[model samples]
Target chain A: MEKEQQKRAIEALLFLSEEPVKTDKVAAALSTTSVEAEKMIEELQEELSAQGRGLQIFEAAGGYQMGTRPDLSSFLEKAFSEEVSSNLSTAALEVLAIVAYKQPVTRIEIESIRGVRSQHVLDNLLKRKLIKISGRKEGPGRPLLYVTTADFLKYFGLKDLGELPELEVENEGAE
Target chain B: MVEQAEYKIKLPTFEGPFDLLFHLIKKAEVDIWQVSIADITEQYLAYLQSMKELNLEIASEFLVMAATLLRLKSKLLLPRSPKFQEQDEEEELFEINTAEELFQRLEEYRAFKKAALHLRQKEEEQKKVFLRSTGGQKIMVFTQQESVYTIWEGAHHLSEIMQRFAKIAAQREYVPAFSAVEDFVIARKADYIYAVLRQKRRSVPMKDFVIESSLWEVIITFIALLEMSRQRKVNLLQDRPFEPILVSLIEKQPELFQPEEGESGERTAKESY
Candidate 1:
């Protein structure tokens, strides 16, 4: 298939997909290698950006998604006017940070670090689909371990956990 | 000196006691290692007093820290003898470097707080970039088991399916008791089960297989299923403990565990009587 046709096909697929679309799926659809498909995606992203389109192709959580430009949110909200606000409190933010960094960590661990009970804060995060009970740590009482979800990455505009800022060695060594 | 300690500071934005400690350390502009524990403890207590005066809803954790700081302050004031050994406290306390441990915890929290601020910025930026709402688009149905957006949603879906199944199962009227044992036709009942399995070409639950009235008939059908399983005509799968036992055909094995033609003929003849 021609590059133009492939780009259009990729664009259509991304627009239609409700979830992130993987490169392999795009490659299979285009009858091209995954590497070739990745190049196509990059080219498509450049084309879209060059065009100054309202939608931007964002790579996150092991796949790609087409979303509105990040800075255009206020204008989009005014245009669409849906009551959507994800304002999280400071306590919630702190708990989320601990979970994001020390994922598969237990509630007790988060509590110990915060020097306060974070049970309700964890419940709120769980309700919001920001964090999930990944599994239970193997030990006495088998406390549930928490991990951030893909929604967490999306909410934070992070491509993955690696996108988080590097922690100082002195800070990390204190643990 | 402890009673004389008064902090004019009014902290409006500390998330918790540790956060307050972090602020105090930072505001003092002294290296945490070099700061005097007695002065820090006094200031911390004074802040706690201010919180009490302002009628703030102080959490128990704050009070606990107050007790800890008081203990550390008392320990700091004590005269150390040359032969003094570090004795364990009366309560269940971890290692006793109270001041040092508090400092370390405050540092750790500050690092995460910085990370949180970075994430907060990202979140603000991402909030502007919105996806097209999942409207007017054909929803992709996920039949094959894969991780969906949220496991909770998957679990909730499973529970709804389970409830529907239970409702259907409950709707199945109880089989009326038989008039006599001779009313049970074992050969025909077994054949019916085998035919159903063949028609479905998939695992059929044991509960769905035995919708008969008589106990003897159900027993005979169960025995027949066991015999078929033994002969490799059908495979029994119990996916989990307490789940329904599922019966499936061995696809490669075309021949069923047939009681010899004459034997089934004779059993049918006897069943007719």
Candidate 2:
């Protein structure tokens, strides 16, 4: 394919993808190597934003995604107002913060840290697919370990868990 | 009694006993380590008494914390031996099992609560950027801007990533057998039902909405119907068991679920990379 045609084909794949499109997927579809595909992706990302296009491409969750410009949210709000937002309760956010930082952590660990019962909150997070049962711990009763989901990253607009702000623990070294 | 009821109504922010205890300590303007246990214990008991008077069923977690506070309060009542105070830092660390443990937990909760606020900010900031739906996503409107908005990722332990990511990143050739499913498919099905009801203007069999006839599509359509019914947009009726459900729109529209139209505008010029 011509370089121009290749860009168009790559754009179609990105558009079709609701989740992050891996570079390898784009490479396989284009019959190109993954390195070249990643380079093209990087170039296209710069081109899209350089033109200040309404539709923007970004690298998130270790893959590429096409989304609306954050600054242009006001203009799109009138048309997409109803689906614009769904704010979570404080309790949900607290539970999510714990699960995000100490992920693959168990419910007992979360409850002990909070000094409260978290079974109900954990169940709700599991239902929402914000957190999942990663595996069972190797200990008494073999309690299930929980970890944040991709949806959790999407919900928080994070590219990865690495994007989460560093948690400051003032007395972290307390004996 | 009236005051306690008022306080209970006003303090919905307190999700549990620790939250209430934290609130009392803050109100006293005392650091968690410095708070006089007796004062906070009395206040915590007072709040529990009010909860009892108001007939609120206190969860055992709150009661457990109450018992804990009372035990700590009794320690304050004990006469301090001079020798006990003269003990070194090692002894103080052991003493932490009884008293400082509660403070440590409270401090940990405070850190997580602060982290939650930071996450809330991230959520709000991300809300400014919207995503396109899969399949029927419209790309008609064009927006142009001069200044660039960039969000950079922070540093974290690289070893920590999803199992899925490790597989994809390590073996570049391993194409996922299928495209990972996003939540938009169900939303699309829901929209399809709206279009069908608008055109027919009569009760339609639910099975007619199932396009692929796959078990997955059947369940997806059924869930969409349930949601629409809950929102009073549609009513599902089945005259007999195992009968096809008849779905019809409610007469009064609730001014919701309006389908968005793609607007045409001057195309923003795109420069070649």
Candidate 3:
């Protein structure tokens, strides 16, 4: 396929996907290698930006999705009031931060840090599709471990976990 | 209470004790090391008092923090001897360590709150952008017709199967021991219920209308109540579904539907009506 045609095809896949579109899935569909698909995606991102369209092609959760640029979000919020509004409580925010930072962590570990039971907050996060039960830890009781979803990264406007503010390691050690 | 009388200041909305502590620390703008323990402790206690006055249910975690602050404040008040024993030094060190740990936790929590604030800002920006639900489809209104049709079809098939099963079960020859008795029957159950309602002369819940007996008695009593409702002998006052049915005898008709009494008042059983 021509590069222009390939960009349109990749855009279709990302637009239709409710969740983030994986690189492998994109590569397989385009009949190209994963590296080529990634390069095409990066080029497409540049192309989308160059066009100065309201939408931006952003990568999140180890994949890519076409989302609105953060700057233009205000107009979109006015256009789609219900869908755009989201206000998380402090408890939920703290629990989400804990999950975002210390991912693949169990409920017990989160509780130990927060100094309180977080079962309710975890449930709220799961309902909102922010955090998900990644898998069960290998031990007694086999407690479910949680990790932040692509929605979480998108909501926080982060490209990935790396975008999270650098926590000072030296300050922790100073104690 | 004394703290409540000293400071009439009302704090802003705080998520938890750490958040309040962070606010106090920021408002004072003092270094943690130089921060006056006495002043902070008083302010913390006043906030707690205000929370109590508002009838807010404070969590135990907040109380734990308050206790720690009080301990630190009291340690600051005590005089230090020039000649310190090992145990005295260790105890003083422990108090200092506790205070330091509390400050460290507060600092860590503040960093996360700052990150949270950043995320909040990002969220506000992102809120202005809305993604299309489908492939470039600006509108996506979900319809329930398909799901509704399937549910009705499923219910219709389930009812048909149940009717067929009932016919098959009815035709079977198996009979239980209780089928032979005829005294405690459905027809007589209505009269018995009528007599009880007339005797009591008050509204009674359907479940209570039929005293605890066998499964057969419960079923008969339900049918009897339904029959009485049909005849207008009693009013089945049910305000809502899934709620108890209140059965009260209609006024001015004191005549009971008296049926033949069994020998032991424990009438012999009959097959279900």
Give lDDT tens digits, candidate 1, residues A46-125.
98899998888988777888998877877978987765685788889989999999988999989888887899999999
True contacts kept of each: 0.68, 0.66, 0.45
Clashing pairs in 3: A73-B128, A73-B129, A74-B128, A77-B128, B181-B269
Docking class of 3: acceptable
Assess candidate 3 and give its TM-score to the true structure.
0.60
State the lDDT at B91 in candidate 2: 31
- Badly placed stretches (over 4 Å) of model 3 are A106-117, A134-144, A169-175, B1-11, B79-97, B135-273
Taking all chains together, each candidate's TM-score versus the true structure is: 0.66, 0.62, 0.60
List, residue by residue over A61-82, the lDDT tens digit for candidate 3. 6788788777786676677776
lDDT of each: 0.75, 0.74, 0.70
The 10-residue segment of model 2 chain A with minimum total lDDT is A166-175
- Per-residue lDDT of candidate 2, residues B1-273 (tens digit): 556555545334477777787888889998888878788889999888777767778878778788778867776787766786635434321123356777877777788888999989988877887887643333232212222222111111223334445655466555343243413555567778878898999999999998777555665787778867776678887653346789988775435543321100011111110
lDDT of 3 by residue, B30-141 (tens): 8655567788888888778887876668877678768778877766677745466224434321133356666666666666666666667766665655665643233332
Steric clash pairs (candidate 1): none
Among incorrect, acceptable, medium and high, the docking class of model 1 is acceptable
Q: Return the lDDT, model 3, position B261.
A: 30
Model 1 chain A weakest 10-residue run by lDDT: A166-175
